[model samples]
Target: MCKKGNEVDKDLHSLQLKNFMGLLVPHQRQIHAFILYLVVNRADADDILQETLVEMWNKFNEYKDGTNFVAWGLTIAKFKVLQFIQKSKNYRFHFDPQLLELLEHEAIRKNGVHTHNERVEILKECVSKLQTKEKVMLDLRYEKNLTFEGISRQFGVSVPAIYKALGRTHARLAQCIKLTLEQRGVA
Candidate 1:
């Protein structure tokens, strides 16, 4: 009876880890966006993501099967984000945590409506409007996953110049998305 109980416990733990891992990786992009929306800093968001992953793994045994994993993960993420905010009080930022929850809810809702193919169609049109130079920068940055420094070396331009060019390109693309959505009455 003791040996059977030990095997059952190990099997349950294994099943919990398997379940947690299955949900963790694919939802990472959405999770990171939620973190970013709350923290408003990419570097800080990345740190929180790592911490969130660890927390999720540590608490795998506590997570019940058949519940919404995204919600559970977001609850953990929200706590970490609030902690980061509380610790950075000296930074003089005044965002309300309640608003962060609203943002998270909105983001998840929006994510469901905006399909990848729809974004890709809008992106193609936006990319077409970009200047020849900006198009190359976008291609190198995304299609090739090249770093700004690599792009700078390739173009014989300074890294800051590459950064600004890519930044402006991104802003332009965002504007295009906004305008496109408004035209479709989707925004």
Candidate 2:
């Protein structure tokens, strides 16, 4: 019950999946080692490896036939490692200054693209110095992407209070990032 083009597409999909699996199976160990190097912990590296493989499987359809499979797979693995580091409980970001500079350069090289890694680190340091409630409020707003209404509902606080808290947090974070960047001669 399929047209000719549909049958051809189905066959192509099957071939792509098979090829991707073939590539991944052979490179699994290398992939794991690369992820481990980035994460620097055995358990976290294992979790990231599993997540990366699952993501690659789910996104296999997006891979172009006859393209560089290893590069694409490594890209997915890198993204998973970054996400794991960002969300980990005992998170300690240890990126070198040169790597940070490279990332910043890449962000600027991309048209209309933006990243806040340096600013986020400075904000994290400053927020760690904040009172618990203020830190929690800021995290809920920015990190969690919760709207004022949603945060208000969750915390049973007034929307205005949430707004005020966020405003104050934003001001403090801005000042902190400015100071940090200035101290590092990067601003």
What TM-score against the true fold does each predicted structure earn? Answer: 0.70, 0.43
Give the per-residue lDDT of model 1 (tens digit) for 45-97: 99999999899899877888789787788889988888888887887664686
What lDDT score is found at residue 125 in candidate 2?
A: 87
> For residue 8, what is the lDDT in candidate 1?
92
* Span of ten consecutive residues with least summed lDDT in model 1: 111-120
Per-residue alpha-carbon lDDT of model 2 for 41-147, expressed as tens digits? 77887999999999999998788877877667778988887777567647565465467446534433421222245555777788787788887887787699898
Where is model 2 more than 4 Å wrong at Cα? 1-16, 93-187
Q: What is the lDDT of every predicted structure here?
A: 0.83, 0.74
Top-lDDT candidate index: 1
Worst 10 residues of 2 by lDDT: 107-116
Considering only N, C-alpha and C atoms within 3 Å, which residue pairs clash in candidate 2?
none
Best by TM-score: 1
Clash count (model 2, backbone only): 0
For candidate 2, give the lDDT of residue 77.
85
**For model 1, what is the alpha-carbon lDDT of residue 27?**
73
